[model samples]
Target: MKRRTLMTSALALAVFAAVPALAVADTLDDIKARGTLRAAIDLGSPPFGMQDANMQPTGSEVESAKLLADHLGVKLEIVEVTSPNRIPFLLTNKADVVVASLSISEERKQVIDFADPHGVIQVIAAAPKDVDIKSVEDLKGKDVATTRGTTNDKEATTQAKDANIVRYDDDATLVTALVSGQNNIMISAPQIMNAVNERRTNDPLEVKFVLKVNPYAVGLRKGEDALKAAINDWVKTDLANGKLNAIYKKYNNVDLPAEMPKP
Candidate 1:
């Protein structure tokens, strides 16, 4: 009877010891154990996340993800995702975190959590230098191009109800429509539109009006407080150390605003 009691106590203590390990098993632990951080990015959006001339993923968001991976001392696995799929990728566990140019919105908050603002992105209207689109109202009766189902599209549709809004499949296609003169104006992030204009000296596009100022943030799966805190801590450290500013300047050709908001 004493031997049986001793065996039971030993088993209980062993299980108690294992419980703590299981309790602490979280996304961060899984990431560390896997030795790779999977970062979802919108590879089509230049200056934020895009492929470089060598076909390697290179952009501000890509660099930011790299920074996180380096901070965690792990390799980065780039997962290409579209704007609409960023949340789905995270929820489905296909991506550990989304480094896409994701703007924080209340609707999205219901499903996923966001880290502090990593950068500020301006959604603006761009037009050929000769075009006279100076404001949202100026877009009336004009052909404006934007990606379907994006904030730009929603804002343009709402503000310029009478405008001939042309919807494209993605930002690349929308920019193509604008540059090809299929559309008189395009609403997009300033970084990408400016880059496109810089490449086209024949017909340079200029930002006519700023529509929205969005705080871009990293998206993580819901309920992952540890992961979220780690990401925010990394952002805070990098922001103070000028690492984020350097990355932003490298891709966007401008420094990140000193007063950029934190989480």
Candidate 2:
């Protein structure tokens, strides 16, 4: 009887797991009715997402998520995520939208849709200035640390084939590893690399080479047209009014691109 019950439960779970994709209208309506917008942000990525001195969530994407919820006339419910699980959270209905620093990639596009981009981030290879790393070719046999399951990971894995890729679970861990001298060479954002340099001042890291400049957007599950349209509209308005750019620049110390790329 126990085995039979377990089988029945498993069958029910499988059916339940398939419901999110089919509940397109419910995703948007539910948020409005619930009076809260579920916005997933990864606090592990500083400048993009992190905690303040008070331990309150304060960062670029965190503020952006707040703006989104406010624009929708709803309260914000932050759903913390990591580099690896942002999309999974959205697809599983754990998050109505993902405001993590998720770059728009053809690879990701195959799995989920994205709103219009509100910001851009440059992926770079950084290392202690003494280390000679001029390009991907220079990464041969070097230990390159990056957050696992991120775009930097994909770039390093595919492009820096000769390098020994060391992936941490998230950006915070990857940054900590760099500061403790666990890894010298790494593929990451300039902001993250700079954060590491601030700690290891005696042996500062520099941008060895730029890997890519990607426009990041809010991620949405496919078929959620209402949510996508709402997010896209908010991005356009905020970008035009300089609200989004202000929030981005406040945290990143750099202005957003002159024009946002479409997702």
Query: Best-fitting candidate, measured by TM-score?
Result: 2
Tens digits of per-residue lDDT, candidate 2, 135-178, equal: 89989888899999989999999999999999999999998999
Candidate topping lDDT = 2
Against the true structure, candidate 2 reaches a TM-score of 0.91
Q: How many residue pairs clash in each candidate?
A: 0, 0
User: What TM value does model 1 have?
Assistant: 0.86
What's the residue-level lDDT of 238 in candidate 2? Answer: 92
lDDT for each residue of candidate 1 in 168-235, tens digit (9 for 90 to 100):
87677666666666776787788768767765679888888898888889888776788888898998
Local distance difference test, candidate 1: 0.82
**Model 1, 38: alpha-carbon shift in Å?**
0.8
In model 1, which regions exceed 4 Å deviation? 1-25
Tell me the deviation in Å of residue 113 in model 1.
Answer: 0.5
